[model samples]
Target: MRRIGLCISLLVTVFVMSACESEDEAQTFADRDQETVKHTTVKPMSNKNKQDFQTLPNDMQLAIVFSSMIRVSEAFDYGIGNPEYFVRSSMTEGEADIAKENLESIQFENKQLKKQNNEAVALLQKTHNQEMSHNEMQQLKENRTAFFEVTESMIKLISQVTPKNAKKTRQQLDQLKKQYTQYSAESVKIMNSIVKKQGADKASFERHLETMLQKQPGQPMLSELY
Candidate 1:
């Protein structure tokens, strides 16, 4: 009976030891899984946070250029008045070059469009020697209106592309908004003068505006106003 009792006690000890080993193994696995989950979980960075130039699209590159221009222009408009304010945001020398190129392109395109518009107006005046029909006159008025509308939009867009300080950006934007309002009034006066002198109808004006819009490169995806 003593031997049997000793055997039974030994059996019980073995079972308890096995159970403890199994529990320890399960706890170790659980801990490892938790660590793996922690390591795998990560936050995705936003496009705005990315600093690399190569990652940006062509339109975005152009926008950066325009943004710099806007900032510089705004600085001058707001009494900050430094050209460096525009180019300072560029990440690299190459980016600065690109920005400069974009500005040049925009200026060039504006000049070309203005020249074309003047020529079109002149041609219209030459063609309409006699009194035109009321319908023809109305058409001319509509075209002139559309052209001015597009011009104002372009100015506003250009102004919006300018970058500003975080503290003053909002104020700068407000200034741009006001400037656009004034710009529109001035544009209307100019358009009326062109129409009155040239007798060019609205259809010709719209076609010219459309051509200008088509010539302009595609805007950036990130642009706030295009």
Candidate 2:
């Protein structure tokens, strides 16, 4: 009887310890998430318009590419910057498959937001050639809100999520941002020069952009969200 009682006490103690450990881990994750807010803080992307994609820091380039891929996927479009294309072309076969799975997993967890994004895409397509009605505009706004809900997760994956190594990760991201800004100034000059010589025809510009993306194969071409 004494042995049985001892065993019961041991089990209770073990269970309590396990529960405490889980709580501690949750707190740690929460702290990490709080720190992640800083990882996301950035100068507006309007700043990117001035810089050529070539001169941006690697991480900044990837960040832009990541955002672009999300837009492409949400819009039900496919191209060099689309999520599947980026994952498949950027990683090895095995890693690419895993990344694809991860994206699906994240999308599953954020299903409602993903659904809203899909609905937004439908509305956007419907209004592509026509003026947006008030309801359409309202839907677009809701879509934007939903899109942002999952943005933190997207950044987490692209920027690296482990908080233990945050200092190193942050330093790298900062350097990339500095370089991205530097290229921004140069890009505006190039764009202005291009516009002056040749009017920005949609067809020609898209052709050029598409050719550029095709040539870059694995590189991300981030959207300006403009």
Backbone clash numbers for all candidates listed? 8, 4
lDDT of 1 at 117: 39
Name the runs in model 1 displaced over 4 angstroms.
Answer: 1-101, 127-226
Off by over 4 Å in 2: 1-158, 199-226
Please give, for residues 144-174, the per-residue lDDT of candidate 1 as tens digits: 4454454444333333343343224334434
* Model 2: per-residue Cα lDDT over 124-215, one tens digit each: 33322213234433444454454343343333443342435444534543443333322322222222232223233434433433343333
- The candidate scoring highest on TM-score is 1
Give each model's whole-structure lDDT: 0.31, 0.31
TM-scores, in order shown?
0.25, 0.22
